[model samples]
Target: MKKKTFWIPIIVFIVTTSVLYLCGHLFNIESLKWFNFEETSNGGFTFGGSLNPIIFGFVIGFIAEWIYKSRNKNRTA
Candidate 1:
C-alpha cells in the first residue's frame, strides 16, 4: 500500500464485513461470520459484536503498516 492509501485494505475489510453482516440478516443467512469470529451462542448482548472488529481491524492494520513501513524504510536507508 502506498502512503496515501495505507488504510485502504483495512477500511475495505471493515466496510465489506459490515455490509455482509447486514446482508446476512436481510437474506436469512447464517453463514456470514465476523472475521474476529467471537460470536457467543447464548444470544446475550455484548459489545464484542462491534468491538471485536475494530480491535481486529486496528491490530491487523497496525501490523501491516508496521511491516510495510519497515520494509520501505530499510529499503530507503
Candidate 2:
C-alpha cells in the first residue's frame, strides 16, 4: 500500500476531531465531546476520557484501507 494512502484517514480523523472540539468549545456545548468518550458536563471539556483519538484514527484508517483493497480486488477480478 502507498504510504500516502495510509495517512489519508489519520489526517481526516485529526481534522474532524479537531473541528468538533473547537466547535464544542466555541459553542459552549456541555454535551459535545471529541476524542474522549466521556461526555462534557457543566459546560466544560474534560482533559481525559475513555476514548483515545489516536487509536480511533488508526482503526478508521485500517478499515478504510481494507475496504479500498477489497473494492480494487473486485474490480480487477
Candidate 3:
C-alpha cells in the first residue's frame, strides 16, 4: 500500500477514537459511556470498555480509505 493509504486509516482511526471518546465523556451520553475514560484505583485511568470503539474506528478508517482510493483512482483513470 502507498504511504497515504496506510497512514489514512491510522489517522482516521485515531481521530475517530478521540472524537467518540470526547463526545461520550463531554455529552454524558449513556450509550456512549463505553467510550469514556474510567478512573482506576491507582490514580491512573483506563478506557471504559473501548473495544467497540476500537473496532468501529478501525472499520470506519478502512472504509474511508477504500472510498478515498476508489475516488482518486477513478479520477486518474
Please name the candidate that would achieve the greatest lDDT relative to the true structure. Answer: 3
lDDT per residue (tens digit) for residues 1-77 in model 2: 57756676667677755665666567765444443444477776656432444455557667776777788789889
Predictions: Cα RMSD each: 7.2, 6.0, 5.3
- Clash list (residue pairs), candidate 2: none
Candidate 3 Cα outliers beyond 4 Å, as residue runs: 34-48
The TM-score that candidate 1 achieves is 0.43
In candidate 2, residue 5 scores what lDDT? 65
> Where is model 2 more than 4 Å wrong at Cα?
1-4, 16-51
**Candidate 1 segments exceeding 4 Å error:** 8-48
Error of 2 at 64 (Å): 0.4
**Residue pair clashes in candidate 3:** none
Residue-level lDDT tens digits of model 1 in 1-77 = 37434675576557755766676557645454342244468965443233444455566666666776777789899
What is the TM-score of each predicted model, taking all chains together? Answer: 0.43, 0.46, 0.68
In candidate 1, where is summed lDDT lowest over 10 consecutive residues? Answer: 45-54
By summed lDDT, which 10 consecutive residues of candidate 2 come out lowest?
A: 30-39
